[model samples]
Target: MSLKIALFGITRDIVGTSVIELPAPAPATVGELLAEMRRQYPALGELRSCAVAVNNEYANADQPLHTVDEIALIPPVAGG
Candidate 1:
């Protein structure tokens, strides 16, 4: 299966786009997905302080993920 991810802030720069598709199989979790993404895009190293959301709600690292789930990365904010 394929999962669509919406990248934001530093994540967008790391991924070079606002969206990305991830491979599926062997189960997936918010943490696992983020880890995999970090592995795929080392540039995301800046995402150490990032949080994740599933279906518009803050998700825990251990939260299970489905192949068709909507995932988004909410990185640290910096503004006045």
Candidate 2:
């Protein structure tokens, strides 16, 4: 049971990939998952305005997660 997280914007650059998959027995909550990722990729911890989306909807820190859940990292955007 693993969690695959889609990466977008700066997150993709920071993580150096479009997707990141956690090893088996992934974290149970959004916050925990993010925390685990941050610990692995210290650069990700530098992001101050990132959002987590689950199954196409914005997710909170305590949102429950499953191995099949669709997760995405949404970073701030800017336009000229």
TM-score of each: 0.82, 0.89
The residue-by-residue lDDT of candidate 1 on 1-80, one tens digit each, is 67888988778877789988775553388888878877887766665487889999999999988766778988887889
Each prediction's Cα lDDT score? 0.80, 0.88
Clash totals, every prediction = 0, 0
lDDT for residue 71 in candidate 2, whole number 0-100: 95
Q: Model 2, residue 19: displacement in angstroms?
A: 1.0
True-vs-predicted CA distance for residue 38, candidate 2, Å:
0.9
lDDT of 2 by residue, 1-80 (tens): 78999998899998899998888888889999888878887888788777789999999999998887889988876768
Q: Model 2 segments beyond 4 Å from truth?
A: none
- Candidate 1, superposed: residue stretches over 4 Å from native: none
**What does candidate 2 score on TM?**
0.89
Error of 1 at 27 (Å): 5.6
